[model samples]
Target: VGVERTFPVHTPVIDEIKIITRGDVRRAKLYYLRELRGKKAKIKEKRDIRPGAKAAPAAKAAPAAPSEA
Candidate 1:
């Protein structure tokens, strides 16, 4: 048994995200992530940066409205 968690990653500039596998190698990190012994061994795909994609509003988010009594 192991602990598993999922979190939201807010990357606004993610317009046309495409995942492409460089190669089907046994190594996970293409360096040594494959030499591990366990079910946590897997070659994850790399996320390539999209061209002409605009990043989300560079400005910080506005504050929420104040509550009224």
Candidate 2:
């Protein structure tokens, strides 16, 4: 896992912080997030939401076949 990573989540300066939904990460390395969008986003709720917060409802997931990395 020490593969020199630069996550955009680091050092952020934003007004609103948001967790669209909790993701059911099956794999530690989610290469899947790269090939999804719009109605195709699919992540399972696997955590307790913070106080006064609600996990966003997911739109219809696009029926996309898993792509090769």
**Residue-by-residue lDDT tens digits, candidate 1, 1-69:** 555454445666555645445445654445465356575565556454675332542333556689999
Task: For model 2, give the RMSD to the true fold.
Answer: 17.5
Give the TM-score comparing model 1 with the true structure, all chains together: 0.24
Give a tens-digit lDDT track for model 2, residues 1-69: 224455465555555658666677778887776667766656767777576333343333346589999
Which candidate should be chosen as best, given TM-score against the real structure?
2
Question: How high is the lDDT of residue 27 in model 1?
Answer: 44
Which parts of model 1 are misplaced by more than 4 Å?
1-9, 20-22, 32-69
True-vs-predicted CA distance for residue 25, candidate 2, Å:
1.6
- Assess candidate 2 and give its TM-score to the true structure: 0.32
